[model samples]
Target: MPITTEPHVAAKPALTTTVAREYVHRAALSEVLLTGWNKTGRDAFKVTAQWPRSHSFYVSEHGMHDPLLLCETVRQASTLLAHVGYHVPLGNQLSWSRVQFAVNPYALRTEGTPADIQLHVTCSDIRHHRGMPVTMSMHMEAVRRDCLLAVASVRFGSHSPAVYQRLRAGKGDVNEVFAQAPQPPEPVSRSTVGRLRKQDIVLAPTPDRLRWQLRVDTSHPVLFDHALDHVPGMLMLEAIRQAGHAIEPARGGAVMPTSMDVSFNRYVEFDEPCWIEAEPVETAAPSSDGRRTIRVAALQSGLCAVNATAELTDTVSL
Candidate 1:
């Protein structure tokens, strides 16, 4: 089938990501969709997929489905319609995406069946920012085996032509990239950096320790949707990472997460407000050599949702 690159107002050259080749699996795609697809734009779509249940790309020793990967699936599927109907051209590089909210049932202690997942998504309200057009937001959900796993609203935007070209030429200004873009209507918390919505804080604390909380709101991108009720395993890890960034002292030091060991206790969902608390339990030698250890805990309703230990290293100054 024709990939959804046709019918744009501007005949912008069709482009796809190298990352797509890595993530796209014909067998998985077929198992999820049941029917093969040609890239075509439709008003709505419901595709399915399955998890390996053994091997995994990152965490998940049993090959369980990943929340972030699920988000990627919905994102690609939703944007495929845009590529066919709207004029936004795909670029080789995708920048950091700001997740407005996500709701995953699999994260809520529900068994997942990827091949049986029912993905429902709709695209609308087009607008332009920084010379790039975007679908105001995406409303998406994932269901499988009679259980809803997740629902989320995700925001995506591309760099301006000038920014893209400059970066491509190796002459983009780093300061500009670090500068804050337009702030959202909601105010982020003082303890958080990248973003904050009520109890949820993004990029908070330091690289050594981190924590966050979940709040109830219609704007929550994923967890608010009706599939499953609780946070996913991957999101839990990311929350730790974001929280760690918030705690790490900004004295211009490089710290990157190298490893993590985590365990899930109970479900933390969007049904009500919940919080994540994390802190440093260990650190490496001061010789600037060796890995540093950090401890984290996520709590909901004053109960432990998840706990983890992370390994970090300082390569250089930030």
Candidate 2:
């Protein structure tokens, strides 16, 4: 879809009116509501948003729904009240300045499909320092039933008086699209005692530099107690990340990897340690807001176990 920023319209309430008739793209909301997660008109200060299908919103090819896109959805939903002249003062504004998600592994599989989901988000506080206005804090949890799928938080900045006027006039140059931020280099940490170990260099990080070592312990989760067996793909990625951290500080300011495409070329089993060497195929660059992307590759035991690129940013709040 071409980029769009529609002008805000006022709404009116009346007797004998349908809910859909009172909202934008009611059909879309209807589909989302069918997923059984919406709670509309339940509270004077709260509202709900939902989608029936993953395709209803957006999904990426790397085996998961794009986290950045979901974050954007939450931002838009939260600001809908302000745009629709709810209790918020006229000209009040909110833009997602940061967001982060710590996701569960099993939920990772259902992400590409239209499974039921709900986001419970709350505004914790807002404050200002000197003349720089800052909206305090807000957190969101994506859940199915009582199980937590993901936990996220965001920070927003209210618009200034002049900026709000421009927005109302439909001439605002503001873009809520967050630009990716430069990912910080992974941090250095102590090495754990393990059966297999090797050191290598990482050329590409969301930040300019990254490097680390690969230590393998097939015994940690002994499959058969014979050999280490093939290392789980996710575990390998985790090891790569650990190695990367050795080169620099963990990208604390970075939005954790929302999705990853990994190709397993071979396996690193228990008895043998897999040494991985990694580097960025591309350098990090500025994204909307303060986010960034980095492309990286890894070699295990001289064999390419996984090769992939990752998008990273610090704009996301945790």
Q: After superposition, how far is residue 57 of candidate 1 from its true place, in Å?
A: 2.8
Ten contiguous residues with the weakest lDDT in model 2:
193-202
- Residue-wise C-alpha lDDT for candidate 1, range 33-127, written one tens digit per residue: 22212322454555444443422232232223434445445545545534433445654222323343344323423244324455666655547
User: What overall lDDT goes with each candidate model?
Assistant: 0.45, 0.41
Residue-level lDDT tens digits of model 2 in 40-91:
4422123344432444223332344435334434444455433342334334
Residue 251 CA error for candidate 1 (Å)?
33
| lDDT assessment of candidate 1 | 0.45
Model 1 clash tally, residue pairs: 44
User: Over all chains combined, what TM-score does candidate 1 have?
Assistant: 0.40
Give the local distance difference test score of model 2.
Answer: 0.41
